[model samples]
Target: MENKSEEKGITRRGFFQRILVGFGLIISAGATGAIASQLLKSLMPSGWFGEPYVYRKVYAAPITEINQVGASIIFEDKANNRKAILINNGGNIQAFSLVCTHLGCQVFWEKERGKFLCPCHTAVFAADGSVESGPPEKSLDQYPVEIKDGLVYISFREPTWQPEQYFRGEGL
Candidate 1:
């Protein structure tokens, strides 16, 4: 009888120890999660950082030789998944973003219509980057092109919302 009583006590103690260990593990895991969440929140940038400004050499072709009047040659940014167009309007070289401002669809130049056409919807932009038809209320984003040493250069930055007649706005 004495041996049986001692055995029961030992089992009860072991059971209690296992329960405590499980509860401790649960609490530790919860704490780890809370700490990780706090750390991630702290590391995130406050508000939106200004769009990254970048300058890239687009093509080596001569500006005067390429006579793509209504057609545009597309250049892709693999890092941000954006496309730009280099248009040769007569002898002048201009670059416009292929991304439609309304719904983010890629626009293609239509030679017959002499405009930039979006296939997803019938959005059209005029020869000088103005949105003439469709849902796009703003003009096509333009990049300043500089030609030097027979190489074409284009400057691009992250899309920013600018107020009317304002170079630097509160949103940017």
Candidate 2:
């Protein structure tokens, strides 16, 4: 047989080996770029990718409204058609929706009774928004609260967090 390497110069084995090296370098560069992109995303501010935030921090009320130790500031999220309460319960601040768990009626704070009273069905909730008695099977829905820039903010969770809502067309 003829010696192909000594004549043709480009050996098949060497060509394949060089092609494999090029492929490996390309893959390595792609992987490195992917990792660097993810790292840069981590350093960027939230929602910088032009996506909606997981939870929108809506301005609820002014911090000055929460003055007394036992005072509560009621606020409405007009865009959402929902109402909530921001209470300074002896310095332990908290907030939750006023919607009744049973039939979606509005609940009111009865400070005299130190509990929430649902007028539609007389369902009673404890001071901490837990179901104390009546027709409701669950407690009131609580939300995350934040204090910044001399204002109080309530975090309204996006519907995308619950996948089931999309199937039911509720998230639409």
Candidate 3:
């Protein structure tokens, strides 16, 4: 009888075609994955990849625009994953971290009281950052300030990825 196995088996040409198709699929998948990765990265906001533990100018505003004492400006440092507050304290400009020393709760400037207040547990901090009252034993972290020409600039150490650890209060 004729070879039954040969009749049912793939021919040499068919085997090669199958192999080429498999390789083409793999290549296409790899190319698509690479393109998708690039597209996602491009859609993210700038400075999302900033390195930790580096000090940088977090914010700048015109001193002339402050208008009044106790007026404050707040902003997020995306690179550091932290918040900051800049206040005009009686003609003296100052900047401080908004993170409360007690439990990392964000603090806010009380323009009427002229101090930073932590609403989490009623923790109160003077505009200079000293803890006025509450459970916190330490003062709020302060950032170095620079006045250039007509603008105010504040510099602070960028927060790291480590949990519950920050460079702000460590003399950075």
Which candidate number has the best lDDT?
Answer: 2
* Model 2 regions more than 4 Å off: 1-54, 158-172
Local accuracy of candidate 1 as per-residue lDDT tens digits, 27-126: 9999999999788766753424544455544553465544556545677767444467788887688888887888888888876776888887788899
RMSD in Å for candidate 1, one decimal? 12.7
- TM value for model 1: 0.56
Per-prediction tally of clashes: 0, 0, 0
User: For residues 1-172, what per-residue lDDT tens digits would candidate 3 score against the true structure?
Assistant: 3333486587777778899999999999999999998888777523358535756774567877674876788756565465677777787777888889999898888877887889999999998899999999999988888888878878877644443334455433
What TM-score fits each model?
Answer: 0.56, 0.57, 0.56
Tens digits of per-residue lDDT, candidate 2, 42-123, equal: 7763435554636767888888888678788788756555578888877877888888999999998988887999999899
Task: Identify the superior model by lDDT, candidate 2 or candidate 3.
Answer: 2
TM-score quality measure for candidate 2: 0.57
**CA displacement after TM-score superposition, residue 26 of candidate 2 (Å):** 48
Model 1 stretches astray by more than 4 angstroms:
1-60, 64-71, 77-82, 158-172
**Sorted on TM-score, highest at the top, how do the candidates line up?**
2, 3, 1
